[model samples]
Target: MIKVLIADDQEMIRSSLEIILSCEDDLDVKGVAKNGVEVLEFLEREPIDIILMDIRMPVMDGVLCTKKVKKRWPQTKVIILTTFDDDDFVFSALQYGASGYLLKAGDLDTLHHAIQTVYSGGAMINPGIARKVVDLFSQRQNTPIIQVEEESVNSLSELEWDVVYEIGHGFSNKEIAKNLYLSEGTVRNYLSRILSKLHLRDRTQVAIWAVENGYIGRRS
Candidate 1:
């Protein structure tokens, strides 16, 4: 079963999500936390497969908690589930290693799919949130790549540039394969090469680097 822990300040939302997830045989509502502090405490007792994190909380926020969790338990995945969709929160959460960014307003099916997607090692993003991230970086596409070394950009091949552009726009591996007319396996291999060439840790860093370097919102 996909073990999940709900971390929301509101008791109603926590319990409501618990109830909703409990119905799925493939999913289990492992626990619930009212805030990030409680979420960490619960984690100390036992590891959960995923965390349905809330952005805003009293003792600690989800973004900080996500960073901590990834640091302490890199195996566990985190999906930010919040009512607010601020651009800062979206970027911060992803930058801090959040596997997914979803709005609480999404339907139950969508939430379940997101949890499953992340559990299966794929990132998920709400359409609205994705648009915001794309827009945030798209505006800076013309800002020029000053900080990144000139040789680093030249290291990638033409095909790798195609992968980088898709990643910068937050497209999934499966989506990128279809978009670029390549198999998923081929895309994954290209991503691995791109990460090594760019000295990025993972796809998230690649996405960030691509945006910062004005790789997105432009043709190859």
Candidate 2:
């Protein structure tokens, strides 16, 4: 089962999510926290696979909490659960290593799917916020690459290079697998290896590196 921790300041929201998620056989509610402080406390004491974190909170906000969690436990995945889709929050959360973003009002199924997607090593942007993420990245096209290390360029295998090239062109894993004539598992394994080899944090970083290094052109 996928263990999850829900962190939100509101009592009702936390209770409601706990109920909705408890029904899924593959998911289990590990714990609930009212704010980021409590989240950190819980993390100190429990073993959690994923976190559904709220953006705005009392003692600490989700973005800060996410950064701390990532620093301390890099394997624990986090998905932002927020009522607002503010561009600043979305971008900040992503930069801080949140694997997914979901609106608080998202349906149960969407929330569940986001959890599963992030847990499986894929990024998830709520459909409503996806356009904003795309627009934000598009604007960064003109930004110069000031930090590409030789290590980053040397770490990818030829097959992984092909995968990153396709990903840089905005192809999903399923699409990349189809084009490469590889199974989905093979594609995912390649990606995981690529991330490790390149010393990258996530797919977004890989995409950025590909574009910045001219491995794939911005419009490719």
The candidate that achieves the highest TM-score relative to the unseen native structure: 1
Q: In candidate 1, which residue ranges exceed 4 Å CA deviation?
A: 138-149
Q: TM-scores of the models, in the given order?
A: 0.87, 0.81
TM-score of decoy 1: 0.87
Error of 2 at 164 (Å): 3.0
Q: In candidate 2, what are the lDDT values of residues 75-156, reduced to their tens digit?
A: 9999998765476776667777888878888788878877887787777667667655556666766763324567866766
User: Which tens-of-lDDT digit does each residue in 63-122 have in candidate 1?
Assistant: 999989999999999999876546667667787788888888899999998888788767
Determine the C-alpha RMSD for candidate 2 after optimal superposition of all C-alphas. 3.3
lDDT of each structure?
0.84, 0.80
| Number of backbone-clashing residue pairs for each candidate, in the order shown | 0, 0
TM-score of 2: 0.81
lDDT accuracy of residue 46 in candidate 1: 90
